[model samples]
Target: MNNELTFVSWNVNGLRACVTKGFLDHFHSYDADFFCLQEIKLQEGQIELDLGPEYKLFWNYAQKKGYSGTAIFTKHEPISVHYGIEDNEEPEGRIITLEYESFFLITVYTPNSKRDLSRLDYRLEWEQRFASYVTELKSKKAVIICGDLNVAHLDIDVKNAKSNIGNSGFTAEERACMSALQKQGFVDSFRHLYPELEDRFTWWSFMAKVRERNIGWRIDYFLVSEQLQNHIIEATIEDHVMGSDHCPVTLKLAIDVS
Candidate 1:
């Protein structure tokens, strides 16, 4: 009950590809209490992994094969778990909620609005539903929501904010949705820790040497309920350890639940 929990969330882009590209090595090295993954891109029985005996794996794959998916590997078994939002209408395997003794952990692979922002309206609706889901979980315990949110909430998050204002991840509307969530008593753990830092991005594009040049967006986040802010010891973007377009972001908390 006096344990300090370390949680890591990563958008692996495609889990099968990532597994071939040092995903297991990173997983063993980090040894996080809870490891959340997004964009798995595979259905059940698509891949086999031996994640060691200590950790338990929970998966939520999309009904459509080789599409959106999310998973969780936790050292501590959850009291209960849920897939997608409570509404159950959106069943793209985009959300996984784990109920622990002291906290509720939610890992999400937010819908991309696309380059032309054609899916902007749907993305906005998803954001609203996601916020409502988080609020509902907060009623039970402290909440930690993580993974690729697919939005750059501030100018400091992306390389060319002025030019990318209306672009998919950097649009004003998407940012507003994120802001609304934070305003509703949630803390962006990374931003709260390093308020003035810049150029620390999570998701990079595969085209045009974007990753090498570090021209990326910090669309991924580890957000917690306001009351749990005090428990946070550190929040980090593991940009160096990469296998996908998106690297992992970690949160360390000195929670002493008894």
Candidate 2:
């Protein structure tokens, strides 16, 4: 089968707040084939949403309430859906993997290293495990990995790069891990599609007037394995449409298997 699929990823900061702030409106407007989300911050009964009749919602909530979480809303059902990289150790709800007939979609909300870099070690471990997980998935089918990676890979990824060098998202070590992943044959879809574009960011700080100044980071991304790179028709930053501090990033691909 051959078809075109549109995928979108966004960090809503907090899903409940985003709903009140018009997230569902933006979601409908995008009308993507697959939708991925991060920072849901809820548990089983904390909140509920009427996602309508056409979509299926999958959620991975953090064991700790009002913390990290993720979700996927897909128009097409997957053969199987897995939460996190494993069964017993996935309490934070940081990752979800869906297996479609032709591809695997892995959505992640990478752990932030924190402003003081206290969680840097844990973040590093997560990256290693995540990279390994994706590599393993690639052995089966084409893969699309999307979510808040929590790092700015290049100097062009954020404003004031010089001053932000050692910051959690801009740290050299973090950037290197991202580079290593891309070198392992994953294409950062947006940058691969639109190299040299400037001031295009998906995430901005909530402090003060950062968004107005465009002092943001391109921490969110859509990455695909080499074989699927050619299938990508377009990758975009939906900066104009917003409900959270982070805007949506979408990938359009000429892909279908049915």
Candidate 3:
């Protein structure tokens, strides 16, 4: 039985591209039990990643080439695995669920709210359905969700809260959806550990100096069922490890993995 489980999640923007930008270097250095990724932007046989035989690979690719996608590299063999949140079955490769002895691990690349809010309605629908799906699984076993969630739920979660008001990631609707998830006995692992901390963010704009100046939004997350709260060793943002517009977030859990 394993005494601790370490998970790392990142929105790589594009996995194939990230390979040239220190992804492999950082990936090897972290050596997490489960390393989750979003926006792979590739399909089966499109690219080869040798994460070694020790790690089992799971990939979900978008119907449209070079679009949204997600993947997970896990060292421990899971009992079973699934793609998408049964009901959502999103065309854009989004969710990957791995069922383990102690918990269910899901990684998602949530749909973005277009600049013009054109996809906001669809995004809201997904939020509700996704939340419902995970909550349902939590009723049976602990659920650990990690990935680019695409919504910054609170004022403190965004660097420029006032300026970003009504913006896609900061909109009231998206925030409310996130609130509903938390209200249902799920915990935002990072915020649960570091409430009142400020300026800590996961995603940054590519606009000049935005990331350098640390002006960003905490859109990515690692949320776990409330019952796993005490098992958490720590939840953190690996902002210093760079490659994608968003940094990696890690969660360490003191749990059995037998």
Candidate number achieving the greatest lDDT relative to the actual structure: 3
| lDDT on C-alpha atoms for all candidate structures | 0.90, 0.91, 0.91
- For all predicted structures, in order, the TM-scores are 0.97, 0.97, 0.97
Off by over 4 Å in 1: 256-258
lDDT of 3 at 103: 92
lDDT of 2: 0.91
Model 2: per-residue Cα lDDT over 153-196, one tens digit each: 98888988999999999988899999999988899999888888
lDDT of candidate 3 over 38-126, digit per residue (tens): 99999999888888889989999899999999999999999998899884577898999999888999999888898899999999998
Q: What is the alpha-carbon lDDT of model 1 when measured against the actual structure?
A: 0.90
Specify the poorest-scoring 10-residue window by lDDT in model 3.
82-91
lDDT of 1 by residue, 1-258 (tens): 457999999999889999999999999999999999999999989899999999999999988788889999998878888888964655689999888888899999999999888999999988888888899889878999999999999999998789888899888899999999998889999989999899999988889989999998999999999988988899999999879999999999988433
The count of backbone overlaps in candidate 2 is 0
Model 3 CA deviation exceeding 4 Å by range: none
What number of clashing residue pairs does each candidate have, in the order they appear?
A: 0, 0, 0
